[model samples]
Each structure stands twice: as C-alpha cells, then as structure tokens.
Target: MRGVTRSAQGRGELTPMESRILRAAVRLFAEKGFDATTVQEIVDAAEVTKGALYHYFDAKDDLLFEIYHSLISSQMADLDRIIALRLSAADTVRAILVNLVETTASRVDEAAVFTREMHKLNADRMAAFRADRRRYHETFREVIDRAQTAGELGTVVPADTAVLIALGVVNQLPTWYRPDGPKSPQQLGTEIADFVLAALSA
Candidate 1:
C-alpha cells in the first residue's frame, strides 16, 4: 500500500481522489458493516474505477485504516498544536473541549466512520492505532497534571480522572450536539470547563 501522504500540516485536505474514496468508504462502512462493504460499492460511490481505487489502497482493510487514521490524525495534530500554545491551563482545558466538540460535530460522518468501524483493523494495526489514541489522551492528561501541580486545580482529584471527565464531556458531544442548537460549541465547552474547574477547585 502507498504510505499515507499529506498535502499540508494541520489541514485535513486530501487529494481529490482520496477525498472521494474516503467519503464513499465512510458512508458505506457506516451503513454496512466493514465486512459487508465491498470494493465495488466504494468504487461506485466514489465514481472511480476499480483500478483507481486499487491505486490508492491495496484492499478494503487498507482503505479503512487510512480513513480512520486520516480522521483521527488530523484531530490529534490540531489539538497538539493548540495545547502547545502557552494558554492558561483553564483556558487550555476549555479550548480542548471546544475544539473536540466542534470537530466531532463538524466531522460527524468521519466520527461515525471511526466509532462504527475501528474494530475491523487487524490486531497489530489496531494496537498501533490504539497507542496513537492513548498518546492523544495523554496529551490532555499532561496539561491537566500541570494545572493540578500549579494549584490551578483541586489537589484532591486524580489527574487521570480529571482528564477523563474533561474528555468524556467533549467526546460525547457528538451523540447529542446540534449545530443549530441553543448552545454553541464554544458555549457548551465553557460550561463543561466551568463544571470541571469548579469541582477541581473545591
């Protein structure tokens, strides 16, 4: 399989063909189980030839892995960049929530693709993917840990628990979040951050 190539950093842009194929893969995989979604379906949905699909991916599993990686990797890169900026831990936590919720909501199809199909990767591939996911979580945990050490957060709360709460709030937003809802993503993020901050300070 061709190694995944990026057109730019922090931009979730894909080659035109890659985009089409990915869109088809996500849609089909979401509606049909990975095992049930065939290369012909993807090629037809993508409006590409069988040879075109083969040029980009070796097989259905390869396409799935690339699609999942592309979705999560872009998110991780965006969050990592934001976290690296020296914003206050409180602000950083809020930023993390907003970013996560907004991304999850905006990329609903991709998130659905991930939640529905990630288990289809072979064990070795899944393990590597899982590690990347853990690193992203660890990124948030480290920031929360720093905040706790600096007395910005409650000393009583375990860092891992604090991180989990923050992430849990953000991660679950896609389940119920509506773009036209009363609360903006930013507002919801602030609310969640406020709850975390208050609880941690107590």
Candidate 2:
C-alpha cells in the first residue's frame, strides 16, 4: 500500500485523490454500513481506478482506519496548537471544546461510521485509537487539574470527572446534531463552555 498521502488537496490538506477516496468511502460506509460497503463501490463513487485505490490503501480496513484517523489527527493537532498558546485554564478549555465540536460536527458521517464500526478494527489500530483518546482525555484533565491546584480554577469537581462530562457531550453529538439545527457547532460549543465554566465557578 502507498499509505495515506497528504498533498495539496484544497483546504483539507489531503491529496485530491486521497480526499475523494476517503469521502467516498465514508459516505458509502455510513449509508450501507461498513459490512455492506465494498472496495469496488468506493472506487466507483470516487471515480478512481482500482490501482489508484490500491496505491493509497492496502485493504478496506485501512480505509476505515484512515477515515477515523483523519479527524483524530486533526483534533490532536489543534489541541497541540492551543496548548502552545499557554492560555488560561478557562480559555484553554473553551478553545478545546469549540475546536472539538467544530471538527467533530463538520465530518459527522465519518464519526458516525467509526462509532458503529470501530469494533471491527484490528488489534493494532484499536490500540492506537485507544492511546490517542487516552492522551487527549488525560491532557485535558491535567489542564483542569493544574488550574485547580494553582488556584486559577475552582475544584468544583474532580478533573477526571469534569473532563469526562465535557467530552461526553461532544462524542455523542453525531446522533442528534443537525447542520440545519437551531445552532451552529460554534454557538453550541460556546453555550457548552459557558455552562461548564459556570459550574466550575459555582
């Protein structure tokens, strides 16, 4: 397999072919369910050749992994950038929630497919996913923990519990979120941040 490549694929920063293939696969996986989607279907939808598809991915599982990996990697990058800014605890938490919601909401199809199909992932992919999630969770918790310890934030709840609650809302959002809903992801994220910050202060 050539593996996933990142070229000048418009604003998504993926290769044009890679972007089309991934989008096609995610749409098919979401609509037909992963078990029912096939490599041929993806290739046809993407308008790419079998050799082109094989050049980027070794198998169907690789496509599934990449579909999920793309979002997580982007979120992780945003988190790193936010942390580097060294903002206050509240500011940092707000940034994280907002970024996460926007990212997760934008490509909700990918998220939905992963949620329902991730159990089929191989052991290595499973471990990698778990590790990335754990790191993101722990890193957020630590930010809250440090702030509380330093007297910059209130200890209204344990940082672990707090982080869990904050992330829980975003993770389960795909089931209910609508692009045509009352609020955009940005607005919803702010409201969420407000509620969390208020709870912390109280």
Candidate 3:
C-alpha cells in the first residue's frame, strides 16, 4: 500500500479506469518487475490520473491482486461450463484443452503477467491464491482420475501427471502462438488436445 488508497467495497465491478489500470499493470509488470513499477508509471501508461486509478484500486498490490483474481475467476467459470457438458472423458478432456488453448491465445499478456508477477503478492493473498490454484488444478486431475477408473485411458499415466501434461501443452502455446499463423486458434487447440488424447490412449 505504498501508493494511493481506496475502498475495496466500491460500487460495481471494475470501472473503465480500473480496466485501463489493470491492462497497464499487466503490461508493465510483465515488462518491468513489480517493485520497479510505480503508480505514476501505471497512470501515465493508462492515460489516467492518480485519483482515477485510486478510485478503483486502493494500491498497486490491490490492483495486481484484482487482475490476478479476475483472470483466474473468469477462467474457472469458463472451464466449469465446458466440463459440465456430458461428453466422453476423452472428448471432454479434449474440449477442455482446446478451450484452454483458445483462452491462452486470447489473453497471453494476462497469462504472462499472472505467472510472472504472482510472487510479488503479499503472503496472505499468495497463500489464498495458491489454494485457489490448487483447486483449479484439481478440476483437471479429477477428469483424468475418472477416466483412469473407467479404464478409458491408460493407467500408465497418473492423475496429477495428466494435469501437468495438459497444462504444459496449453500453457506453452502463448510462447509461440500466432493468430494468423498456419492454424486457427481452434485448430491449434484441437490439435494439441488430440495429441494429448493420443498419448493417454496407450
């Protein structure tokens, strides 16, 4: 809280100013470290005033937490929706993986920001966020676990191993993904999912 201050129980969700500030935070935090970024720098890049920035976020740490929470929370909803569809385990897993790829492609900057700047969070918030992250990973783990029990997939793979492999494939896409490249985002997602499904088959 070395910067400005505001209330957490503001009116609605993120306002335009808050959105701008969050976007700027994502960029700056990814480019410059957390400690290196200043409120002035964020406001300057966001084209907003100090008052505007603080009106939505209390401090830089608050802004970072807000961004992180927003990203994870929304993705959880999306993943849950996809998982609720009653497809075969393999098909469901593929759909989830494809969804992940598209999501990463859509928000590579946020992904990078979240992954890189996570350590900058305060201890209390970090512990909470880590718990949330573990729950998120459990969604993937549960899917693989069910598949294993049903004998639909190879037992050679462990549940957590499936989660890691799935994440590793989807997370790496942002590093080299191009929207207008050879594959469409959906196509790339399907391809990656297919590879994972194939590997798990035997």
Candidate 4:
C-alpha cells in the first residue's frame, strides 16, 4: 500500500526550538491534560519564549496534532518500505509489528498524550488522523487476506479481526508499558508476533 501523506506535508525539518516546544507540550499534555496546559507552561518547560512557540505552532492544538502526526507518518513510511521488500507474508507482518512496537516505545510520552488528548484536535486534524489510521488498517488487512487466499495462512480468524487483535495491544501500550520494564520493546513485539502468526497458522 502507498504511504499515507503526512498532515504536515511540505513542512521542513523542525528547528531545535520547535523540537523543544513539542517535547515540552507532550510532557505537559501527558502530565496535566491538554485543556489544562497553557502556552506559558509549555514555554516555561521548553525554556523558549511565547513568540518562539508561536513561531512553530499556531496553538496548543497544533502541538497535539503534530505529536501524533509525526509518529503515524513515520509508521506509514516504514509500512511502505516493508511492503516493498516483497518478503513473505509472515515476515512482513513480523517486521511491521517489531517496528511499530519499538517506535511507539521510544516515544511513549507522545503516544500517551495523543491517546489521551486527541479528541481536542480540530475537526480537520481529526479527520486526517482517522484517514491515516484507516489506510494503515486496510493495508494490513489486505496483506493477511492475500496470504489467506493463497493458503499461506489459515482462516482461523478473519483478516479484519486479526488486525484488530494485533493493534489492540499496541494501542494500549501507554497505560502499562514502562521504559524500565523487564521486556524490551523488540522482545515484546516478537512475542506478540509469535502469538499472532501462531493463531494464523492454526
């Protein structure tokens, strides 16, 4: 499947100040909730002026959208790359899961904040987010569907159901996953992939 275009398409790389402001916003949004976070608080946390913050992001809503947008954009790129490799269906699925887990784990704060506060985004941004996610979901389901049709995977569960089961765990990572946890993200991802592939084989 083609990579979904980023919401911030045509935006160049973020300057250092922009990165600082985004990091501060993610931290504050995760800690204090989006509505409670003020622009002044983000500036204070980022150690930048209010003007600096506005220079990169128009409002708090922009920060929220950017946080998740960057993540999903990266994931979509990885998905396209994996699909282009022409790997076996199981290998492709494994690579996608591993990449998703590691990336999400690396930016746990961003994921957590976005998951908790994404409802605050403007309608346009929200629609963009949903469309990106739907593309990812449909692409993944197509992979499984083709594999099943070719008899490479069993039909123990429908492709859509399988996608939901796989993604459900990743979506819940923020609530319980810890950076200092016993299992590394890659390890957790492998185990999850093992379970998923096993189910498909059954």
Top-lDDT candidate index: 4
Q: Which pairs clash in the backbone of model 3?
A: none
In the range 1-202, model 4's lDDT, one tens digit per residue, is 0112335462324567767888988889878899999999999999998887877777787888888877877788888899999999999989989998998999898999899888988887788789778988998899999999999998999999999999999989989999999999999999999999999999
* Candidate 3 C-alpha lDDT tens digits along 1-202: 3221122221124556677788998888888878899999999999998998877777787877776566556667777887888788888888888777887788777776777777888886677567656767998798889888999887777989878977886767657777778988799888888888888898
Per-residue C-alpha lDDT of model 2 across residues 1-202, encoded as one tens digit per residue = 2233331121124577888999999899889988899999999999999999988888898888778777877787788899999998889989999999999999888888899999988886677668668878988888889988998888889999999999999999989999999999999999999988887765
Q: At residue 158, what lDDT does model 3 achieve?
A: 90
Tens-place lDDT digits, model 1, residues 41-105: 99999999999988878788777777656766777887888888988887787777777777777
Whole-model Cα lDDT of every candidate shown, in order:
0.76, 0.84, 0.76, 0.85
Which has the better lDDT: candidate 3, or candidate 4?
4
- Rank the models by TM-score, top first: 2, 4, 1, 3
Task: Give TM per candidate.
Answer: 0.86, 0.92, 0.84, 0.91
Q: What's the candidate order when arranged by decreasing lDDT?
A: 4, 2, 1, 3
- Candidate 2 whole-model C-alpha lDDT, 0 to 1: 0.84
By TM-score, the best candidate is 2
- Compute the lDDT of residue 116 as modeled in candidate 1: 67
- In every candidate, how many clashes are there? 0, 0, 0, 0
Prediction RMSDs, each to the true structure: 2.8, 3.3, 4.0, 3.4
| Candidate no. 2 TM-score | 0.92
Write down the worst ten-residue block by lDDT for model 2.
3-12
